[model samples]
Target chain A: MSVDAKERPLTPATEPFAEPLAELDRQRARALQMGGAEKLAKRKAEGTLNARERLDHLLDAGTFKESGLLARSARPEARAKTPADGKVAGFGKIDGRWVGIVSNDFTVMGASSAAINGKKMKHIKDVSTQRGMPLVFLGESTGARMPDRMGAIGRSILGQDRYEYRRMRETPWVTAQLGDCYGSSTWYACMADYVVMRKGATMAVASSRVTSLAISQPVDKEDLGGWKLHTAISGLVDVAVDTDQQALDLAKKFLSYLPSHSNQAPPTYPVPEGSDEPIKDILKLVPESRTQVYDMRRVIKTIADKDSVFELKPGFGRAVVTALARLDGRTVGFIGNNPMFKGGAVDPDGCAKVTGFLVLCDSFNIPIVMLVDVPGFLIGIEGERRGAPGKIINWMNALALCTVPKISVILRKSYGQAYLNMGGGRNSDEVALWPTADLGFMDPRTGVNVVYGIREEDDPALFKQKVEELSRDTSAWDLAVLYEAQEVLDPRDTRQYLIDMIEVHRLRMTNCVGEHLMRTWPTSFG
Target chain B: MAEVKVASEITGSVWKIVANIGDKVVEEDTLIILESMKMEIPILAPEAGTVKEIRVKEGEPISEGDVAVILEK
Candidate 1:
């Protein structure tokens, strides 16, 4: 302020722009510092990756192209304290395929949602959608920025983006719940096609503090939206892991099974060793007796490429196993009835899980391979209250509308409406059966009692005769004789059979792309 | 010591009780077998524990989520 215009020294005719550029360096250094060294060290000691480190672990090495490193809070007073506006967002190569990412930096103002970060999120989402790339969200937030969102100005900006929550299955969306997730974080995770949560993470509408105040009672944070609630009860999360690395690895693995966008075929990998080998162990895993229970996951693993089975919602719907795996190097969705739980009967959660998997596979041009061994649907008061009927029809509806190739293999018991839902009749492109396959409206012993009023206790011999008669024409051989199933195979030949059938049913006319009839189906139904 | 209540995951009649009171068990060891949909479904120990109580008898019908056994670990 001491120097007047006349007293100030004249600038050099040619300035190197060194001072201004140094200020640019200072600004970038401040953004990179990210809530300062102490907070970042505390985060490191807490055994979780920082925001930038998460991006490095998630994306291919040296491929992250950050979008808004200079972005700060919209409020002038808060600008100095905000870094990346609490959100680190950009585009990066995941396994050499481009994906847009948003990683919440908890070191910076709790990574809260505010005007600048919202714009940054919208920008990444828009570019990812418009340019055909998968989008990922690494979520950990403390709801909206306080005071900035507490007034008329906040109300005006709250829902200004109409398409904020509108999900179009244009490209795959994946999310990871890394810590306390509330508000937008929870919504994004809920709407994500695939979500993975760290075991200790919590995701909910509002944090327990607000929730407790609203309900006038103390609320346990974990009970509100912990991994157990999401993975085992609500079916909101696909998998729960012990750490952030596992969650990010799972995200990469999941993206490997999907295409960049709905209009293209999923990328294929080199077929793993032993993929074409006979699955002799499958015979050992499945019991020959119709009433014996076995783990269908073993059968699916033997049929898929070696080390290729990645299961989704494994804990929630124990009756059904939905997995993304590789068959002869190409991506395939495997829906199998797990006989180890509920005697392989479908339940409401199972129905919803299968329906969601069907939508994902069909939308992304991945063919489906269903391993059928279901007895029937589980009927009970709980199922009725959970809208089991609607969920069942929703599964059927998605299956009928799906344009991707769907092949089915009947392992043992395929009965009642579960038969059609598991890809019997005209539901699948090709159906095969093992010698153990039993096609029936119901179990023969149960059918005898329901139809002929025959009980083994009352008339043992007549009941046995009636059961035998009821089961007479329900064998795999009968189905083969009637041309209902395309072929009957020894259980060991299942791996090769599925690979051959998938080759036969490839969408040659459409350049390996499906019609994507289920593209607009809801991301989750339960 | 922690008490764990083992519940039946399915509605079925208890076919057999494999673990007796005070028996030491490991995780995933089948403690009871229930027959439903004409298939034998084993209710396995959720964790390593000593069986403290067997709450049902053979052939007794039980609903899903009903506590079938209690274990102390």
Candidate 2:
């Protein structure tokens, strides 16, 4: 007969509790096995750490307080093998801040199929959202398990987890695509605020094996979803690292720069020590010749704090360079036109990139610094087919919706609707310009051709004189005289002016965060 | 020897081909000029090489990343 422990506490003499205690010890041993020692050893041989080792490296020492550690698969045969339901979900400290982590244990059933895995994921996501902590997903799953999800209805029933698909950007979400990420993992990658992918990791909706079968064509996994494809072309993955260690480190660093949640302002480093390097160097970096293309990246790095720029999507939509940097220790998002690509004309892709960046900065309360040098939107058969106008207007809407402090500095060639899109005239809180800035409906050469109906080839001498006449009227001084731009600054004074502007405008924020005007705008997947 | 292709960075009409086929060019040499967005964009040779082929003639429309010249070293 069993003793009624509910009536009284157990004593040392209680013989009935001995067997149950032994069983508890056995269950604990089973929970810790995590697909057994052989798998762990194999993973170690692969020159990569196991799930627990990764958690050890990612979280602060002695800080990981795990939840759902004893959770096993619902299937009878799979129950003993699928320790922690092939998933590790818990709260931990990263850089001394609480963060929720969900890592798939690829050793167990390939971390692919389990009902409780989805539930555990939801638990961490909900907990992270409620507790105002960032969520990290270290996914390396092989997609839904076919054996467990064999029935037709089983596939549909899997989506029943309410929190799995529903997105609430209460806290920053970061994902690390460590290995073969498919199905739900791909969705999480897209939905994340930032994603770091391992160089060899394959991320897609389905594996090449299955995709090839369905389409009846051989598909290379790398070509289908490679780091180069995402970083340079698709603009899906934010950062790609060569090692798993690097991915974890970069994630921690990225979070350190951002606020814990959207309601708060981003963390700011101490003001840059010592005076800035002579800003006069920017003059030498930028070519005065309107026809020449110089490296805009150099100009950005020189103006912003030294080594502060962290560029996003450096390959895709390369005509525009979007980066997060510090100006006088204040976090600012920069959108500068790269004249090296498409002469800094905002293409359809570039428009989409800028729009998404504006929404992100607005959401995180990072102030914006626009270095305008766009000639105009891409005008061609391809640009039209790509829906350039739709993208342009969408970006314009985002810029208008952004409540964060926006300061526009026209470097050169601010023309067409692009002038407004780049925060010209009334669009920006404060508009400044360099002495060489040109603000107009179009470039003077194009303006001359449109107005006079005389091509440059038809009358070379007349065209040159006409362009000069138009150019004289379209200078930065003309705009300043008309009270269009507030100040026409020298190129050297731009850094200081921005620092001062940030200080002055920041007074408008009471608790450091803005009104969250574009809070609901979706982050761009590309 | 390696073959290099100099590509235009903008969608524009080919205004002029400065370096003819079989001509020698240094790094940063303008191989072809494209007129787009009301500006003349010079497609430059990435390395010192001899021009192997001219991809497009004058007045022909070309898109971004379209190869304008091939160079053999």
Q: Estimate each model's TM-score.
A: 0.95, 0.88
- Tell me the TM-score of model 2: 0.88
Residue A181 accuracy (lDDT) in model 2: 87
Q: What is the interface RMSD of each candidate, in Å?
A: 0.8, 2.1
Query: Candidate 2 on A241-262: residue-level lDDT in tens?
Result: 8988998887887787678888
Displacement of the residue A300 alpha carbon in candidate 2, Å: 1.8
Runs in model 2 lying further than 4 Å from the true structure: A1-29, A152-157, A272-275, A278-280, A507-509, B1-7, B12-62, B68-73
* Candidate 2 lDDT for residue B11: 80
Clashing pairs in 2: A235-A526
> Which runs of model 1 end up more than 4 angstroms from their true locations?
A1-15, B20-27, B47-52, B71-73
Model 2: residue A297 alpha-carbon error in angstroms:
1.8
* C-alpha lDDT (0 to 100) for residue A310 of candidate 1: 94
Clashing pairs in 1: none
